[model samples]
Target chain A: MTAQAAQADQLASSHGHLVIIGGGEDKERDMAILKRFVELCGGPSAKIVVVTAASAVCARMWETYDRAFRDLGVTRHVHLHLMTRHDANDEDLIRDVLDADGIFMTGGDQKRLLAIIGGTALDAEMHAALKLRGACIGGTSAGASAMSGHMLAQGRAELHPEKGSVSLGAGLGFLHKVVIDQHFSERQRLSRLLSVVAQNPYLQGIGIDEDTALVVERGVGIEVVGEGAVTIVDGRAMSTNVAEIADHATPELIDVRLHLLPAGSRYGLPGADDRDARRIPPPLLEFLENITKRNPIS
Target chain B: MTAQAAQADQLASSHGHLVIIGGGEDKERDMAILKRFVELCGGPSAKIVVVTAASAVCARMWETYDRAFRDLGVTRHVHLHLMTRHDANDEDLIRDVLDADGIFMTGGDQKRLLAIIGGTALDAEMHAALKLRGACIGGTSAGASAMSGHMLAQGRAELHPEKGSVSLGAGLGFLHKVVIDQHFSERQRLSRLLSVVAQNPYLQGIGIDEDTALVVERGVGIEVVGEGAVTIVDGRAMSTNVAEIADHATPELIDVRLHLLPAGSRYGLPGADDRDARRIPPPLLEFLENITKRNPIS
Candidate 1:
């Protein structure tokens, strides 16, 4: 198939927006990152559902987001409690879930959040809202980590690739083929993300820095929002000593296609057209182009 | 490179197809699942050869399937059996297996079948037929379980998800990343399926219900055919205490994604697309489009 046709086929199935934020989002002042979410949800009038299942202080998490949206002039909003697996499939919540224009998740424990809702009817509805109803789905910190189909559940914060540092789990699947890590720069989690990418290699690891968000447009490219950068670790062509490493041993990662994308930059979705390849964001195309440029035909 | 492109490239190297059926596929009436196997084999003109190595009652199994194929208008159908491991390399059988458009294996003891044919010339020919010369391979029950890279040989039938309830071994290697279990819901083998996946969350466990088939389209998505469901237990991101829990102790499985797909649903090959996640008959998609056609998203 033509590259265009192939890219089109990949995106033909995607019908939603994803707003994945790093931890320590600004709730006060401009609230620029969260406002982008509100705007994507069809402005202040859109009905939004905030899932605070990940938080230990669920009520506080709910109140915080509730007040944030209210200040943004959102008229209709509600908090979804998925404290148990049963609550994730509660019949009464189905209608509200279906009607929602925006589905936002709060930060806390991503593992705890997914444990209750994974594979539940509520999870299905959330998928439906995104895939069928064109909803803008936003998440922060732990919420951001759970957006991937294969989520990186746990890993010790490290600056070097540790063999046994990273632990993975399934996520809500807004994004596939990529694992997200929040508090990237702030937590110095470059190694945690690197560990997974080195082990799998085929999987792309994306680490979102604190106060920043990666806004994924439906079936298109991604835009960086907020103050910090989004670090992408693509190891598809990398060489590593992962296989030779002992348990908890640090491994060497070489020739990995790493990109640190700062705010105000946009990147082409993988395999899509690269009309703006030579732009501010040095993503797939630009990087590949640079390689070709470095070694000229002459 | 795009992961999809990489995956497609890997799958394309194997120019073949697999029609994996759960136990007790219907031979009488419409024989929908078997018909699908025939269709995948390039219709009635296709040469079909059945291997009854797994069955203790080989002749009876052969007769039933032979008659079923004949009724479906297949004229060039034959059965090949291996009474011993030496019989697997019988020169006469080699030509038939290598030339056959479709190679169907019967239900019985997978271990017994493997002991006779594994690594033999006939087994090599089957892989050659599947990989080198594009052929359709259909399997039922034990035939299905032996198709995975790591086959589930034996497991206790249990209703509740239990621990240490599974036994694994090598197989024909038709599918990787998944372990197959036939006679699933009919025999209440969910626990057995869960046991294996929980132990190694990386491997997905697929329990195929009776009279159903999971049609794997090479390098593409999968389509479910027949009367029952295909239960997919994905624990890739599941949080479990398997490491801390003792053997035979029921480990807690958190964040596992489960899907019970019935007839005619299409799922993305390795990565699933939830748009076709629902159970609906084949001819309903057009109706779905017509109903939703009235209103177009702006």
Candidate 2:
């Protein structure tokens, strides 16, 4: 695909706001995201749909949602579960979610969530609602990590960035360019994030600390929210021994230069922005202009 | 690197059994791995270096080691904190780890471990120790994920075996030609693993379940240990999907024929046993051989 098309694709939006909260037991932080979630859902009175994919709070999830919706004054709240093959095509659940204004994925193991919904009818519907219908999508912890194209599962839990510490898994790819790592600082996972970036030089990695959230606006790019800093690892500028290393031998020594961007800063990737800081690059700017003028693919 | 040569390189020293475990907070499981680790260390009395890059349990990692070592009747135990920039290259730590007969990494956040030690002086030394000195290197969860060449960071968390849910990152590459995912069954991450192999059509993907270990016998291949099954996602015999689709708008979908190999089965990519039915074909064997022998710079 051409760089222009890539930018245009990134700019297309069927949703108002996408929020990814880092994992932790921060009710206050969660509430902030929930508030935005409600706003994106078309206000406190808007109907809401919540999906508890990888949550340990299984039976209690619906009750929790009931409380949240009641406290927020939402007109309606529905909880959907896709744990089995049959659940993949639950028409009622899909309809509720698609018709709702906001969809939220609860935290647990993202892998579990993906396994149950991936390639299923519900997954297709969910994508359609978010991509075509402009529905708000939000998640926390594993849910947050699942929103990006690249998701950090587990890394070799070491203090240093090693060749194999950062393990990758599948994510939702809602935000295509960035990979998200949760419980970042509280867990001290900088090395894993860096190692992850080093693995996929094509991706720009973001590590959101606990209590933090990354607010991604379709065309505008990412903004950070919450109590902690969001560490960003841009591998585009990295120089490495990856290409030069001999096969099977430990990779040769190389230093990676990293950029730590907290919430609120907007950055663009290669071809997406002008090299000069003064003006928007012609290529990306044109692409964005196209997105604004033409109808989205959905 | 002829298969023979690669064998020679791995066989050059003991390197013992390279055991990588997925994440879980099970003491019994940890104890079992510890037992294996001690055996790999050559004896309880043998000086064993325990590195807790994965676990924040560094402060008490030694106690765990001591308890295990003492229970095993092995005396000499060295616990080091290799979590910071300086600690990663602590001259004494490196020398101790290199000098020791066994090297173990605790579980916590593999990303942290990778960051500080990756491409550092200590990393090189440790690899040398493993390759030339026959040291046993063990890790769990994030540690297990880091063992492969293609590490799965975060990708799309969909259950579809499509090209998006999983993203590939640079892994330790100790086991080239393989991509790893941890906590497989419990997390229901099969689709992500399948999609990862689909993108990397040539590589073999191994999904290790919690409390499970993949004992890779260098040239001989892998043996699964622990309670759960090691899901092996092999795309070597896979069929392509380009023609099935109408346009490039659809990313490649993998009709991955998955094999869930339980603990105890041996896996050798293609050339391991001269095409035995029992082993998965090591697709990269030929390419790996050619690359090694010719040493192609380009």
Candidate 3:
């Protein structure tokens, strides 16, 4: 494995973390999703900071979560409503972040979340807290997408990657080097996400399926949660002629490798498992290999 | 001056090109913008290729341009109407690009434009045309933003060089090396742009004021157009604690400098043109000096 791969392995074992909760209609049925987060966070009683950036969620989404938070006995749950029209530099949001033991970003528009919180004291505070305190940060749906700097807003179709179909918007940047795409499986957004990563080789793309979450512990790597799989696209390892595309004036074939890890599996860079980094299970690896084979650059 | 600066100078002076009109208010206005583009190309009667990606003009934007196409005392006009639905990818769009003489991107959501044309055969065609034919591609608000691969979707109102307020989405990727922001001066968006460039120094950040456009000729250099100034934030000269930010924390000041240039001004990188490269013009030099002086350690 390359040094970056090795470094990724190190991240898997670190402690600073960000987790995602799948947000589909069956979220309530998947109580296991919430339970896993609580367990990883050392229980629901853990002091938590909840930031609601999604407008789609209202009292209903909260009701679904109230039980989870209560069952976990998280009494000091602080919800920071960050969707207000205030500038991203709002002192209130920054202070809330600084004081929080754990930070939770709600799902909605990655653009809105990044627009409101990115580049501000709040964004800085969260990064510092994650790195220094090993504080946990979590999100769902749009929230999951916000975990990474590269996000998929909307696209033409999953058939092929078009110009703006696979968009890279500003995410929370919590997963700074990676791009996060939500509702992966159900949405069949693989093509869109692939297009994004291909354009930006510097980014690693992660796609989270519904009812699934990837609990990423800084220095500790990633732990999968709930049902379905998490698709990881690492373009850094691929070879490309993107710079020469114009000269050729033809659609070039790109070699992209993907990893489809199912729930409970752990994936980190090389050496990630000196502690608990899970190896790519045979089944998942086979599935990913099949995908690349079927989609072999045409 | 650095060697890159000198190279930029030589490139700017050597390339004679056609202008692509991408943004404006309406087709009539877009057409007027196209007319301006024709003037830039050579004269009002110059043969122009209009690539219509504007939803407003896709089906109808061409009809409106009929008069100008005929009345410009000329008849050579290549108009391609490219539009994609939310989940549809039509191959014809790419074909449209391959046959274009000069390309014009219409205004709308830079996101939408990217969605339809992103990684398709069309994107390669446009890029090839530019590099080989020296086609002038100009976009207005959305069009201009799409010129750069790192296009600004939206930003927070934060006016500090912190992190997270400014979010970037994927654009056409035609301008891969730079990150661009539009409607800059009108929205008071300098700090956000600075924060963006600071986060990723490998990419240059440009903020184009409303009505103003920065025309960059690949082998030549860049020239400003329209009403306002183009803020160029070159971070390669920066020395920062990127290690801290990479570790999921915030960036500490090290050494950074920025340059803000008005229309008609230019910057030359090494091996380009060292002398008469706009002379660094006092105002532009002052802008660069201020960034370094403001924070010795960026």
RMSD list, candidates in order = 22.2, 16.5, 18.8
Query: Each model's TM-score?
Result: 0.45, 0.44, 0.43
Question: Between which residue pairs do clashes occur in model 1?
Answer: A169-B237, A170-B237
In Å, residue A282's CA in model 1 sits off its true spot by 7.9
What tens digits encode model 3's per-residue C-alpha lDDT throughout A1-298? 7644553453344466677765562444547776666554445445666676564564555665665677666676766665554734687555667755577666666677766666667777777776665566778887777766566665543333333445667655555566777787566665566567656877766777887887765543556777666766666645433454442121122234445455656645444443666454432333223221211111
When sorted by lDDT, best at the front, the candidate numbers are 1, 2, 3
Error of 1 at B210 (Å): 62
Span of ten consecutive residues with least summed lDDT in model 3 chain A: A289-298
Q: Is the docking of candidate 2 incorrect, acceptable, medium or high quality?
A: incorrect
Clashes per candidate, residues 3 or more apart or on different chains: 2, 74, 66
Docking quality class, candidate 1: incorrect
Regions of model 1 farther than 4 Å from truth = A1-14, A268-298, B1-298
What does the lDDT come to for candidate 3? 0.56
In the range A86-177, model 2's lDDT, one tens digit per residue, is 78677865778766667788788888877777667776666666667666677888888887656776665343345665677776666566
Who is ahead in TM-score, 2 or 3? 2
**What is the full ranking by DockQ, best candidate first?**
2, 3, 1
What Cα-based lDDT does every candidate model obtain?
Answer: 0.75, 0.60, 0.56
